[model samples]
Structures are given as C-alpha cells and as structure tokens.
Target: MAMIKTYRRDDDGVLHYREAWSEKSGVRTHMGAVGTKGRTRFHSTRSRTWPDKPTATEFLDNFTEESAADGYFPVPDDDHGWLVLQCWTFTADLSHPDDQRLFEHGQDALDEHLGWRGVGHYDGNDLGGKPPAGYDLDGTVMNLFCKVVDTGLGVKVVRSFARAFHLTPYHVIATREPGDDNDYVLAWSPRKRDKDFDLFRL
Candidate 1:
C-alpha cells in the first residue's frame, strides 16, 4: 500500500498532495503532486488555499481515492459563498442541561434571520449542498454567508442570535470575512453583559 501525505508550503501556504511507497531496498519513492490547485466553489479563483484543516484533509482523502483510479485528481472550481463558523457550547454546565436544544435554537435563529437572504441551514458536518470538493463543515462548525454589511453589524446580528438562543456572547467564535486576515471579530458582545441585555431588552 502507498502512504499519502498532504502538506502546505511554509512560504506561501499552498497545499500539495503527494504519495510515497517503500521499496525493497529501504528507499522511499515519492510521487509528484496529485492534484492541481484550482478555484473551489467556496473560494475565489485567485485563492487556492484551504480555508481550514478539515477542508485540506478532505481534499487529501479525495485526491488519494481518485489518484488511485485515474493517476490524477482535479481540484474543484466554484465558490459556494458560505463561511464556516466554529461554535462552542457549555454542554457540561449543569445549568445548561439541554445543550443540543440550545444549539438547535441557535440554528433556528440564524436560519430565520438569514434564510430569506439566500443563506442556508446550519449543517453539522456537510455543507448542506454540493460544497465544491473538499470543503465540508466540521462536527461543531456551521456555514453561512454574512450579507449583512460590515463587521459591526455582523456582531449585532450575532448578539441577536445569541439572545434568541439564550446563549452567552462567547458561544460564537469570532471570525472575519472569508479571505480577510484582519482582526475583525464578527461575533462580539457588550462589555457589561447585564447592562447590554437591559439596554437591548434582550
């Protein structure tokens, strides 16, 4: 059997997939890059980088299978317009017995808020649609597009979602617009939780 490895260049962070096999002489033969990076459905043509670790692993897995059959795998080229968001819930908190319920509530809130705006559901593992290739949501991650303008407004939207789901502001993992590397925390809460809740009547 062949051993496959996926790696990114330290200088440019471009991912490469390669396969290796050991010979009888204790020498390892490494195959060339299996797939050519291309524009994915969830990314732009110029951005060939993997959005997350899971996505990179997914690409490697698919490339391994296809390379075995055809000697090469074609990278997908489409942008699904969805951004991945990592969510954390205090499942062990005694006060939050129904963590799953809270999660569902958050999903519902987000859906209701963004559904009519062309956004999709809070998919648990998959992207809920044909997410190009190699772009799937993690177990605790959800995907959506923020068509809600700036990051400040995005934070307000997140706060509203948290309130609707009866969750603290910390539950939302702050993220930026896909492809941006700035310190734009999309999810934010007020300094004084109690005061903010009172002010917003949440």
Candidate 2:
C-alpha cells in the first residue's frame, strides 16, 4: 500500500494538507501536502472546500461526482492521469516512541482515502478482527485495496487470470516497485500487454 500525500485546503477554503511519513531513523517529516499553506493567501489561484469532512473514498468520489456534474476524473486525467495509489513497504518497528506516530498517519490517511471512495470492501475469515477506533478500517490486502483505487480513479486494474480478467484489484503494489517477472522495474506501464507508448502523445 503506497502512502499518498493528498493535497487539501483549510477550513477557510485554503488548500492545506500534510503527508505523514516514516524516515529511515523512524523519525517523521510532516511536510505540507500542498507546501507553504501559510504564506499563500485565500484570494488565491485555487481554493478547495471539503464539506461532510468526507473520508478518502468520499473525497475521491466527491471530486469525480463533482466532475460528472460537468461530466467525468476529466479525460486522460480522470481516466489516464496518474492515480498514484501510493504506499510504503518498509519493515519498520514503530514500537519506538518517535517512530510510533511517524508512520502512524499511514493507516489513517490510507483508510480515509480508500474508505471515502467506498472501497475497503473486505469479506474473508482472514480479517484480523475489526478496524480499531478512530480509523475507517483495519484490514489490508490486494483485493480490498483495489476497490478503493479503481473506484477513485474510475478505471479497471487489469491483470492476468484469463477467466478472471478484472482480478487485479491492486493495479500497483508496493513491491519495492512494480516490475516484470524477472523483477525489472524500468519496463513497466499500464500498457503491460503491448509496447504502445502513447502517454507522450507520439
């Protein structure tokens, strides 16, 4: 699960958000999600207002829904723009005081984004009890992860398993990185099936 630093605005309709991350020393750096929310004034170029205090799923849904009112994620943007479903796949011992909350928001922000999109859909005995309080969810896996990403992005995560075409709930996984069977990262893309590099508009 890739941790995403989503950008948001303040209550006054000023964009302000911060990404909570864990560093190598287990220390964290809560950088502004949009950077310098203070210096920028409200009479600004952009203003984001989030009512209902929507969760992650709701956040993405609201964006798409609002766009649909105008009509759809906004072209290659909604459909093809970088969904960037991010996460960190590190083996950290958060039991340390400093590290405790360093990566703590990882789950919070993650659950918020995915839940708001009505994703986090889980139905299996493997669930390790219910999600703790103050959080929108608890469990984590590939399939459940997909529901959140695909719903938010409005596109299908295509994978193998011919009979089960839409089986790739996790379009992108935090595998140190996504690569071919040989574990090569340089040659990856949505067009995994072909070599048609149209993203640059050649």
Q: Which numbered prediction scores highest in lDDT against the true structure?
A: 1
Question: If scored against the real structure, what TM-score would every candidate get?
Answer: 0.32, 0.21
Per-residue lDDT over 1-202 for candidate 1, one digit per residue giving the tens place of the 0 to 100 score: 3334332223454323334333332223233321222222221111245333333334445556766565343222221122224343343231354446655455656655443222222433212221111323222323333433223434544555556566643333343443434333434423333211111111
Give per-model CA RMSD.
Answer: 17.9, 17.9
Q: Could you tell me the TM-score of candidate 1?
A: 0.32
Model 1: weakest 10-residue lDDT segment is 193-202
Displacement of residue 15 (Cα, Å) in model 1 is 36
- What TM-score, to 2 decimals, does candidate 2 have? 0.21
Error of 2 at 62 (Å): 21
Instruction: Give the per-residue Cα lDDT of candidate 1 at 163.
Output: 64
lDDT (10s digit) by residue, model 2, range 93-166: 33543324324443344444333332221121111122222333222321112222232221222112111332
Best by TM-score: 1
Per candidate, the number of residue pairs that clash is 4, 20
